[model samples]
Target: MDQLLAQLPPSVVALLDKWDSNVLLITIASFLAWLVWKVIYNRLEILTQKTRFHWDDLILASVSAPISALIWCWPATISLGFILEDYTQSKLDWLSTLKLMLVIGIFVWITMRLVTNIEDYALTQKNRDETTVQAVAKVARLFFIVIGALTIMQSFGLSLSGLLTFGGVGGLIVGLAAKDLLSNFFGGLMIYFDRPFKVGDWVRSPDREIEGTVERIGWRMTIIRTFDKRPLYVPNSVFSSIVVENPSRMLNRRIYETIGVRYDDSQQVSLIVEDIRSMLESHPDIDAKQTLIVNFNGFGPSSLNIMVYTFTKTVNWVRYHKVKQDVLLKIMQIIDNREAQIAFPTQTIKLDLENAGEFAGMQPQTEHQQ
Candidate 1:
């Protein structure tokens, strides 16, 4: 190792020999880069408080520029190869091999940083979806990985065309072996194009009804966070196949209820219907342009039933519930004011034998007295 170290040229030796060794130069370079990066970062962090454009802030927050500078460390290591190569040709090959690996690693790391930057930028948009952003970012990262792999192979003097051809044939065999996985991957693509539901959407399927906000869209799965703070992960293929009702997409939802009136209070049915229609028309949230209906549904065993139905203009569930509640309270007050009774099941019976026996026992004495 000492001979190997000695074989290096004086210029290389001088740089390496400084202070203690070449390690000190590496330390100095690293410290300088770090110092500049930190200074710039502190300035950016201070400026972030004043700026409204958050993506630029994200660029600083993520330290993308710093990450770039850190990647420069690999090239500095590779530069040693150039200096050492002049000393020994065999050492040159070894350095070259090491340089190739470092280059690929740096490329992948930078690619990941770029993906994160894009994802962060997407998150700042008002209408942008977090799921779609992450999905696309992952796709971009995967693309970079494939390219980096090919480049690494090419750097080693591998046949690019032959490798691609072999990969294509091997990919077919691997794909067939994992058909279900591929189905899910393509299903994710379909979801991106079709857009049946988006982030923060509340959806219900036939077997499961859950109110959730979409968290992420992965190649094989979609993640949702429910109102209860639980995460629900469903496969993309399953989501594509199932029938999902997106409540958030609806402009309005119909409210339906039944109110019962007493059999003796049947005369008030038409009046009640008229009052309900008036109530719906006067209500601020109810959609006046749509049909507001109250009709005599049928007679129950003990009461006359009326069906009341209306639609509210707003899609917000909480607001819709409040409006329906207010309408119900007003209708109950109207029923009370009209002096009509709400009916419940009751039984009436007549007694005949007991009264006859008491009168029969007293009839003979009354006849004698007469």
Candidate 2:
């Protein structure tokens, strides 16, 4: 690189040094680097578009400017150091450290940018979960940042061995002081790995009153959008201790309801049950492969209870309700066709032999009082 710089024409060097314009040199170098990176990135972008994979595009895009900046920085810093040493007769000792830090920072920035691009691309895929992609990206960024920080510290003459020992002790103390916060963070990691539920899932806990659609799952807490439209903030650690039911993952929505018919319609019970079973089996929305039970559940005081247990093909809430409504209406129509009605409570009154005469005498008086 020094040889290449020396190979420059005397005319150009003289032009640059006429007014000792170091700022102009840096500006011109920056512009040339930008133009070169722009051209390289454009070419890489076209090539990536032709390739079968997309990740290469992300890598190329992420590394382009950072690499160009690195290329520009090496010579720029060396030139500045030379220029300053000639004028001041001493080198800026910290300039070397600054360059080291800059290199480390640029690499970290590149990795983090690449992670972000991958995260966004994953989100664009229909099957990818937004929460999982974001979590993975965050972990990647954190890893790069930690590495960069340690590298920078090493550049500054800090002993990594001493730092590690101090960090271990300090980490232990911090852990003991913030147990709950750490627990929540680990719980979040567990959530990401186990995937009991993700953002936008309908999760309900039998152990606690946490029933809602998960809006956001963070390191410390999860934000739930309850059915009542209120936001419920739950610590992630609570999920570790409780049982969460993810209704969104269910393949079929169950329709378990007990329909009642008048006792007078007992003769029609067999036909009604058979017809309901047939209707559910042939229904497009119902999943016949699942448990489809339609039978007389019990004998009520005034009506006969017929339990219908079945599953719908769709797990969507709105569509499930519509299907349930249609099934119920069909059942009602079948009952009406059989000349049977939905039963209502009824009672019959009777009088004893001794009270008959008293009632006969009181009947006229009660009627007159009314």
- Point to the candidate with the largest lDDT: 2
After TM-score superposition, the amount by which residue 289's alpha carbon in candidate 2 deviates from its true location, in angstroms, is: 1.9
TM-score of each: 0.75, 0.86
Query: What would you estimate as the lDDT of candidate 2?
Result: 0.89
Residue range with the least summed lDDT across 10 consecutive positions in model 1? 18-27
lDDT of each: 0.78, 0.89
Tens digits of per-residue lDDT for model 2, 13-80:
67666533465666577668778878878888898999999889889978987888787777577678
Clashes of each: 1, 0
List, residue by residue over 129-177, the lDDT tens digit for candidate 1.
Answer: 7657766887898898988888888888899999989989999999999
Candidate 2: give the clashing pairs.
Answer: none
Off by over 4 Å in 2: 1-23, 64-89, 351-358, 362-370
Question: Among these predicted structures, which one has the highest TM-score?
Answer: 2
